[model samples]
Target: MTIADKGPRTRPFEANWLARIGWLLLALYVVYAGAQLGFSWQRFSDGLGQGGKFIARMFPPNFTRWELLMSGIVESLQIAVLSTVVGIVISLPVGLLAARNLMPAWVTWPARGFIALCRSFHPIIVAILFVKAVGFGALAGILALIIASIGFISKLFAEAIEEISLKQVEAVRATGAGFTHILIMGVQPQVLPRFIGFAAYQLDSNLRNSTMVGIVGGGGIGATLFTAYQRFDYDFVLAMLIVIVAMIMVAEIVTGWARKVFQ
Candidate 1:
């Protein structure tokens, strides 16, 4: 067992010439991008001064439109909740069918395709399409978020199901259980917690998206905020932003509590 007989000890990783060249190229690109974008310390300093004046004008936010704000908030909540419920209900079956171990290829392929289609676009893009098809309002927002939620949760849920312990599933099948019975007894128990987690996450996401969809005339606080911006009502815009932040914080807290309790 001499040093030379240790079978050529592996050398520690060191930066190679190629790695050094890559770093140099990255630095050069950053400098070029900064120049192309007109980035300058003097311009940044001037912009800070302009920002200070803008902030001064936005002080003492106007709550005179509290009624309008409340209405918008309620509509957003409804859209988020409705979308979550519908998405969760639909995703359950789709996810189950997409799990390759549980379903035949014919069933899984179509289910996967549907999930892919649902998730192909951003929620805002989907909302725009729905707004065009269904006319503008909460309905369009709800449909758009529902599609987004289904695409997200269903894909993750199917993967979770696929990764579950097949031994338990096989045991259930060995007891002369039907396919549905095996799913209920074995598969559902293993994946239920993960499913709940995905649902909670989707709810949180939908709440955030509900506010955004309104910018495209899908009824919510975003529409009001956009209008305020157009009218140069920076004070009202700031107020709306504060309310949105508070709402999102509350939602996060509630969802955390639900996850803990359920777990």
Candidate 2:
């Protein structure tokens, strides 16, 4: 048969010239952004020299302020734990109500709105607001982190509930179980592990954020770190950094252990 007679035979896709041009335009935009951000070789070389000087000044980190550091760490721990507990307690009902399949529109809409409001701002900004509202210190930080945790976990929890096996739920209902009973027996079992995972993750994040909220006078290690920065005490700053890193690592390990135990 002649090639022309074969007509439109299927063939491998060839790269369109338009697509190639689009990629070329994207590359040009990246280069433009780099230039706008002052990402030049000369600027990088200068930054390295300044960084080396900063590093030299940070050597032999002073730990003479051990008492202050310990106090701040303890306060941060309290804030984190308090926020996690409060957030988890509040999230359970809100999450259940936000699950569309499980709740009427009147309930779901308000629950979703509450979640959105909680998530509307960064934790630091929320902490600042709380500090203004309720006065500063660990209380403000705890309240802020609690709001953030509720926003995060509740939304995820609702999604987890929505994705659960409907067949199991149907079977429970068929056994003449009421809505509450079905939820307790069929729905809770399916999503409990994931809910635990989310709670642990929120606790870990709250620990890290509790430290940062102190920078804004909400109370924690961050306040001391900010004071050290104001005094140009880079050695103390380095010491604080080391301790913060250790705390985060320990939190991560503890969270992992909890997840494993619960699983």
Candidate 3:
């Protein structure tokens, strides 16, 4: 071997001084920002005292308004299920169209733009708009959640489609299959499980969001909880909070089960 053939020796690992300095600067900025926000020990101490009293008032939550609670819960469930279905149906086509690897620029651009518009506003803001436009109710909540679902699931579906093996799609095409047939045989099989998983997640998210949308007059358990809060019905508020927490936990369990089943 010629001496000139060997490259210079180098360390196997080296520290990045720039990253370390950046991290130090970030830490310093956080401290500076906190100081600027007027963080003080005395205010924290006072907050703790208030928190204790608030907890004391929340014990032994009232559940006497079972009928009202049940109605709200049922409405929320309906919103979640219906919105998930509508979103899944719509997202499938849009997502397929948006996949850059599968579609031309003309197709992907419009599909992507639509998804971006849907996601531009938070669901709460969308709910507020629908509430004002539709004059408030479960309809508004459902519409808002449907938009949210479409915005979210469509993006995932597009990316999933993009990541699929083009070789499989080409193989289907080799048999002189039409576009629809190629998509069904090559793409749908790859992404169906993922689509199901995303749908389950969206349903769970919709259930939680449905409760909050009602606070803005969109209709659900949130409306009842908001009313209880306005009336200073602390015990009932506590009961509602507990129920919401339980509902969310149950949804998490169900979604986990669904993902496993589909996987």
Candidate 4:
């Protein structure tokens, strides 16, 4: 074996064979999926005209139905606040129970399982179920979003707790502080900021979900939007959509302020 005969030991721009093969497979799958989904350049081009007409119809949004809009908006706000408060309250204990470091295996297992169950269905699906069970209304929407908030916030809260520095907790324990005292004095402080941030984020998410839950008879602006859509009153639909957007924007602002306050 002469050095020259070894072909400089390696080639420049060496390829990752596994990566290349993976990319090739992904490209093939994307093409297959696109074809199956009826995605085509011509179809997209043709849709643009319809989209323009729809946008035109949406302009000069009819807000003559101000009372209807206000009522739905108020209901959505109520649902968002009630769900968020309930979810935050429930999540605090559930998150503490789910913390692997702070809790026993028996405790964490059930807590984690409950959170998973809450997350198993989308809010809309849950709302539908609630409607089916309760015969439709804002109460159904409130319950659906509370479950969603618990699932999302509890998971995040547990993860945040796990990520917290344990040195403070250990120091408190060394002082013979009881478990409850340690959790109160040590653990809560470390996690409170993150907890608040999570709560605020969940509240914002619930606001958006509250709007949609109404479509499934959960009650809110979504019902109005759906009705307008069914009636082909796109101007009214536009009005509903604008209100929803404004509501969401206000929530975002509030949560943003809250997140900053906590952090």
lDDT string for model 3 (17-81, tens) is: 99999999999998999899999889999999999888888888989997898899889888888
Give every collision pair in model 3: none
* Whole-model alpha-carbon lDDT for candidate 3: 0.91
1-263, model 1: which lDDT tens digit per residue? 78899887786886599989999999999999999999999999999999998898788888899999999999999999999999999999999999998889999999999999999999999999899999999999999999999999999999999999999989999999998899899899998888888988998999999998999988788899999989989999988888988998999999888888778
Candidate 1 segments whose C-alpha is farther than 4 A from its true place: 1-13, 36-43
Question: Could you tell me how far off, in angstroms, the CA of residue 49 lies in candidate 4 after the best superposition?
Answer: 2.0
Model 4: which residue pairs collide? none
Count backbone clashes in candidate 4.
0
Error of model 3, residue 90, in angstroms: 1.0
Model 4 regions more than 4 Å off: 1-13
Error of 3 at 105 (Å): 0.5
Looking at candidate 2, the ten consecutive residues that score lowest on lDDT are: 6-15
Q: What lDDT would each prediction earn against the true structure?
A: 0.93, 0.94, 0.91, 0.92
Candidate with top TM-score is 4
Mark the 10 consecutive residues where model 3 has the least summed lDDT: 3-12
